[model samples]
Target: MQRRLADNITSDHLSCPICRDTLKDPKLLPCDHSICFECLTQLIESSRRFNKFSCPVDRREITASSYTLSAEQWASSFPTDELSLLLLQTISGDTKTETKLKDGILCSDHPQNGCDFFCFGCYKIICSECAVENHRDTECNCKNFKNCADLAREKLRDAYDEIENLIITGQDIVFKEIDKDQLLLQSRQQIRSTIKKLKTIVQDFEKMINRKCVDILSKVDSVTNVEELKKRTEGIVKDLKRVRDEVELSKSLTSTKDILTVLSKIPESLQKNTDLLYSLAVSDNPIELKLELNEKFLNLCETLIDQPIGTVHVVPADTIDFEDTEATVCSKRIKFSSDVLPLRALELDPFLAIQLDPSESENKITARFTGVIIHGHSIIAIDNANFKVQRFRDTIENQFIDEVLIQGIYDITNIHENDDVLVTSPGKQSRLIRLSTYNSLSIISEKVTENAYFSISQLPDCTFAVISHSSPTSSKKRVNFDWSRGVTSHIDIIDVDGNVLKHFSENFLCEPNEFGDPFIMPLKSICCLPNGNIVVSIETKTNSFISCFNQNARVKWTYDLNDTPEGVCFDDGKIYVFLRESKAVRVLSVDGDLKPVSTLRLPNYFGDGYSLFVGRNLLSVIDRTELIRLYKLQSC
Candidate 1:
């Protein structure tokens, strides 16, 4: 009968409201419900933005007024449910000595009496006399001290076990990180060795070409006498000059005998000159002596000059196929796979337009999506004008999934490994907010910045490339807008902790005034490719351009745009740039020197293609007209 009663209590009262399992270390909430401590911590963390959480059972909201406390402390600040603990102990058959230990704890206020009950209202262990004198008429709930102590012991034991498990997890993570470091070191060594070999081949080729050039010149010099030919030509020129002088002297004579003598000598002089010319022409002419190279040798040299001495290929570690041995370099054999779709070959399919205007918003602002990303089958966008982050299904109906309120949200980017997202809010309170999308849309944490961040992209190393822009008016009050005022823009590489690792400030063609200050162009958008190359769009007063930077923040190339560029994203190996004024998307190849591959003209209804996202076979664009258009991409 006792066991049956215990089973009924466990079934009715012992289950957690969140996990629906038997509550372990259950905490009592203000709404008179119990939940597992872990569930409560997650709730607090997820709702830290508002410093409040909704009870999973009753849907009642609980606010934590002490915002300085961490999530763990907030969860731990709740009182443990002594009654639930007592019931759990009763079910576990661990309450045999409860009666004997009922009087073990002495009351602090009433020193002569042993503590018998735990006062719920006062949160103190008290004797029967003290409970009657202080808490009895005050509506304080009381429980047996021995049962409460037993339950508290069990809770402590569970907490100890949790800590032990966490320690083991930490150790495992450390070991894995060490292994990764070793692999990185090995990879660096291999790269250095390969580069050294390539340099040696180039140096040897240079020496071989020098030796071949010397041999060809030596053979040509041994075959002819340049000095003797020059002497023979000079003697022939002297004889011709003498014959012309004699003819001129004879023509000046005023007698027939003198003319006849000059004419008789003319034939002898002409015959002698002609005979000398014929003899020289019959001999070996130096100009006619050509260097005839071996056909096979010339062909081999041309082939070597046209082809690359060696190629250094970099690929993702996961994509490397070590077993493929068809091509080996530096004792490493890798099989290359081509999975990137060609942008020029992509054909646009039927598109769907999804309305982004929220029905319940009180402000009637046009929806302006400044950032967008496609995660899984959902399209997430930042509604800049509406101050919200909205998610929707990528289908014909375009069903709304969820939306979270974020003030002054400017851009959104994905954290690929976990599907979480980072958003920038560069308004009165500039910050970078991270949101988790595992089970629901919830703010994980936020990092405040000194300046307003406009665009953000996640780097290959898991850091972030963010563009921060600060205008003079933003710092000081201005009665009117000044176009000549200098603005500052920086592309900052930041880690997960929001620490700036590196920053780059690009120089534009702006003349300094008397104060020697140059106006900085505003960076509009940024995107990071898989190979750690960063593409940033900058807008000057008259022109706009997109610059590609390598991992070290060195500019690789810059491509000029005909119109203002609003957003940029890398899909496969092509860079997709959205032009706001031209209403077009320009696709450029990363490996082809940033050459324009194709231009996708947006329809008139797209209305200023502000932001775009490209997936495996889908392209999503969000415009300023409160709509998100989805287009299916197919290989032609």
Candidate 2:
């Protein structure tokens, strides 16, 4: 009833390496071969033993970042025999209108497994024989591979569609956010412009008011003096009164005749003065006006800055402390109080968050450990993956620029403000390497009894206490089946130029070296109190412990933690220790007390718990894979 596809086929299938199981998320290596995720992890785990893990197909060296898969399709949705044959026929030749052939193809490589191997990209084939020759390797990531051409095209097409939609959404939101600010600014500008115009109008009114007054004053002054003005008014009034009295009496009287003559002259003079004043007043056209401004303008401006970004309210405080029962010391937990308030609300626009490789942000520093040296507009990471210093432009969009060309070192373990980088390259030769921004790589000239991994603590300028685990060149004391082990089994103190600052060798450490990833604890992992003492996490194979030593390297106290203390760091005024075997991270107080764990969520990190680092309020935990997990401290 069902027809098989790959049974009598040529090409179009691959095999699995680990369980010989159907390779679902097949990743091709640089060797033109493919392996499953499980097989890849096994290869990485076996690196220390082999030192070189290569693809079985072409024998090219495999690194962690180079695995590739055309599509993320799962193996569970495989096609059946008859359906797979029909699908294969349609994919190979032309469309098959047969309704019976729709179930899809059964993978010939693992025909019994019933998984299909027809890659949406390669169009070629891969049987279930993986860990042998799969194509998802890093080299196959680019376009134009015959086998994965179709898949790449389809995936790229879909990615573009999503990115386009995101960009459109983001642009729209950004436009609105910008408009919000612009609207406020524009309103303020308009009010100021209107006020300026009003001031001009008020000045005109003042000019008119003053000009009218000046005209009246000029007419008064024309009379020569205040006494003259009084005399004229009296003369006119007297003349009018004499005429009226003479008229009431006999008209033939001599006084009446004299009053008539004075009256005529009085009217003339009065008319002349009145006409002059009226004409001057007409020309001046004065109108008194009072300055007034809209009271609401100022109030509107005062509220713009503290306004909410979106639906969220942002009331800024210089510092915030948690109000939780389990709150750690000095921890200020910033919770997502509500989705309505966004810290970066303006970023809510449909921006295409094309998650590019974050490694693309920070270039690989060539030295062992590099410190952030903020110079100009660039933040230089000195210890690049190679022996070259990689520089990143200090901006939201970090861009890589020129690098310092060097050789023989890939990282700086610890960097200080003094531009000093501590490099660790203890393959066969053991040396304290120091690289400065100005000078090249230089090795410390101090000699110890045994050459092993060393970590140092700086006490003062050019003076430090070195912690080493080497036991007196002990050919006399033989290492049994169980002995102290760690990359930095020994510790020492050195200056910026790699000189032995001070030697603090103590016999206080856990024995039978079961500890791993020693250098994970930074220099801050150990410190001295005001009593002139020191506390440090000593690298021990069986039981890693934090040891306190006096100034003379005399072991004073040791806190035996019941976990494989692989990586440790200090934060929130306390020491946080990571246990590899138990998969639990503990926060220890400076006084050798463990606190409760509240916010570390790492699940897929299957490791010996060896890598950890603290940044701002979040802890970055790495399982030595391509993926990194960030555990944020919860706020009270």
Candidate 3:
């Protein structure tokens, strides 16, 4: 009881562009359009004839990050469009679903024959004809099956178990949301307390201003006594006039007697007049007052009045209750991993590996690797001792295809949006070299430091962050914590033309710990995360740590470790750090707390871990022992 194809929801998305039919074994192109695997094989073959494989819709060349699989291995190279296939299955008619299962039961080599045997080793269903022809000499445990019923049952059981785990995890997430709500409530109370304290401070300031205004006004009133000053001045003038008249009268009197009396009276009169004049002089000067109103203070008050404090908003918590639990179980597949769900663990295997056998021969490059990066299909490595940058295909059988002989090559990193690689040379005057090709390299940039640069990584803005050891050194040791340790290191962001954009000193680089001591360590490696944060690995006094910094050059968080972290790279919100002593690569989340996601342990014989590059499902690790190992990550 299913809808017919004509009666069903049929749109452009429902049909494949190549076959114009329901998409089968859909393979997605780089442009995001998908077609059947069979159709893609034909398209690839046709494009191969023209020396290019491109998407049919956009005609853009396919340059997937995956290692180039041979012409015969196209099936393994491209990722299957699982979501498209699932959508097609959900919308297709019931007859088509049955036909789809039956289509898998038929053998590709012998369409007339039905596959009755399942090979557990190959994980493929084979017909009797294919079993005798292909599985006869193989080391496989083959079991007879009717129509994949048993296989389907096993898949169903796995799906059921995964669903149950999702149920439990979902419940846990709901409870965690409740905990967040409780924390929010506490934060709301704290905010309210802070607001109340602010109000109290404003009230206290108002009272202080009122007291100051009253005191200043009283001083102004007491100083403005004009009437009292005028009265004192008039009395002093009258007393002075009387003394003058007495002197005149004495002059008119007799000679000797008049002279003696006049002299005595003159002394008394002069003393009295002098006393009165002195009193008047003391009270004569006007009281001056100056009051300059503060323009900034007035503006601030007006601003405060215009934009008074409003009520703080408390964001409501998310609803945790489910509307229909039965519908959730019956409809969509349960989410397992919080990351993408149906919880997956990636199991890594060697897709392509090369243990370079370097011999002293003419026109041969050394295998000593100091740094590594993935450039398109090529895995590029830096030979620090030999001063050579070599490129090799990601395939196991491939040797160094091309190499650039440049003097003083220490490290190599990929540019932000270009295929170009940035090379670092610590002592060389031209510290950074941009490599456009294996044979082409130019000294495009130089480090802005008197000291030697250890490593450099490109930021999103095409600017490079270069690390210097804070002192010139010939020693191989990049980081030292003893008295012999170099001074504070520097992380400077420079443009491609060698212009210093932002220079971060020790004050900006260091992060304070629980004891409030800044973790000022020697910088070893630097890289920018996709989220616009720069991550640097440093060797601390006691151990090692990786610190992530925001765009403002502020430390977002610090991840401490026991082993010394050397080369580091950030991709897809995951940090890849190489542990020098332990010879392992640790992957962690780019969050503030630096949550541990996974770790890959390298063989001891691989030597000390130097650098690591995480490509799309591919990880390339370079070690001090002149070895570069590539791992193919598969989700299980």
Candidate 4:
């Protein structure tokens, strides 16, 4: 008897399907169907025709025509031509399905079995028993269900695409913002570099100027001392000569009466007269180490009388022992300083004149920016750069807390009373850099929005203004322009902490026509007066006049300097204004209603120049054809 595989048997010799195993000592039910005679009888009995399975394999329905086939009938019915190939194909498909089901790592919850269910919530895997056990519990600790987990996995592709697009777009925006910032920074750096060059030239030329002054003063002093001593000596010589001439005349008396009078003189009176004459005419009076003069010296004294001597104060600064390195001098009394052409945000459309048929505002006041100084807890100056200026009060402390190089940037334009620095580092690039004396430097603000040109100014009342202009005004007069106040310019007042307090056009300003309502501050130099009035130096916008307004923001006076005033300050009971074109410093009454009291003359031979007052005492004068003057005000 040969042994064979169970699957090799024909359908006529098929065994029980419930366990797909050979029948043991067979048990026959009353229906005469032989099945497993062990404890699996219940499983076998349920594998019936309507809704049953006699075994775990090949549980397809069994119709009357498919049941009880004879050996010859089964052989004819089964696929014979390609039976082996068809069966192998079926087995391969089943194997693939089983492999896919058990693809991932086995379930930790059911270590002995491969995972057949994917949990959606827990994002893990479990065998059938572990999954059912968790689900049957009221809590259902399973993290994920099979169906839901499939959905989450499908969403990943879409998410990846979205992230890619976002990254590309975000990078473009960041790059563009950085480009803009670098351009502005480069411009500022150029300005600083130009200033530095001029400063060196100014120093050299000023030295020559002071030396010339000292030489002239020296000549005047030399003449004065020599003349004073000679005059005193000459007076004594003249009196002595007069006395000798009188004695000679007396001896040459022509009348006999004078001779008889001389002979008749009493002996006692003669002795007294002789003694006095001797005293007056004595040349060898060793008792008179009193004075000695030769005839040649006397004659020289007479010649000296032709010219007199004078005194002078003009002297070379170099000749004086003046030592001050810190630029802390107040501009109040300084005539020449090192800081000159300090540039800040500005808005100008020289072509605007061509637009409104030359009807545009020729006045400029608000757009012009100046430096501010803040002094107190920490010293900082807000200048052209959009960062705070810092310094070390003590050298050792500075080494411990140096935040950045002052020369690293160019934005320090001004200072405040409290010294919290404000720099013009504008949007994205523009930052109010607060360099701590102890902490690392950081950018305080990030700008999501930007304006065209933001110029800044601060008043004494702790108020600051930002003047910004829109796109350039059209040069074409006939061009359609919505010049209504909003079209050209705007101003904003903000607190020290960057909160917007108010806008210049806050009052419902009526809309305008014709070259658009003159929407500009055009203010160049702003000097806050002790009386609360602001002396704002404005440029000619549309041929407008230079004007000064009261604290109520009222224009009290105006004077067309004709030349633009680049910087302005109050000093010595007067307003000192820097004239760029005129190359001069103009002094006016504090009210801005007077003529220049005095002008400090600069030698055009060297070069044209300008100056800005840094603090209460220091003046930074620059832009000279040859020299710059770092003038520190001296206490008179």
TM-score of each: 0.42, 0.32, 0.41, 0.31
Q: Best TM-score goes to which candidate?
A: 1
- The lowest-lDDT stretch of 10 consecutive residues in candidate 3 is 336-345
Model 3 stretches with alpha carbons more than 4 Å out: 1-347, 361-366, 428-430, 438-451, 472-487, 511-521, 580-582, 591-594, 603-606
lDDT (C-alpha, whole model) for all candidates: 0.72, 0.45, 0.65, 0.43
Provide the RMSD of all predictions against the true structure, rounded to 1 decimal: 30.3, 29.6, 28.5, 29.9
In candidate 4, position 349 carries an lDDT of: 15
lDDT tens readout by residue for model 2, 167-268? 999999998778666645655675688778878986897798689779777865664454764676666567666655655654465776666765566566
Candidate 2 local distance difference test against the native: 0.45
In angstroms, what RMSD does candidate 1 have relative to the true structure? 30.3
Question: Which candidate leads the pack in lDDT?
Answer: 1
Clashes of 3: 2
Error of 4 at 540 (Å): 2.6
1 or 3, which is superior by TM-score? 1
After superposing candidate 2, which stretches have Cα over 4 Å from the reference? 1-419, 427-433, 436-488, 510-535, 538-542, 591-599, 621-636
Ranking by TM-score: 1, 3, 2, 4
- Which digits, one per residue and each the tens of the lDDT, describe model 4 over residues 355-415? 0111222332111112323233222322222222333222122222233433223233233
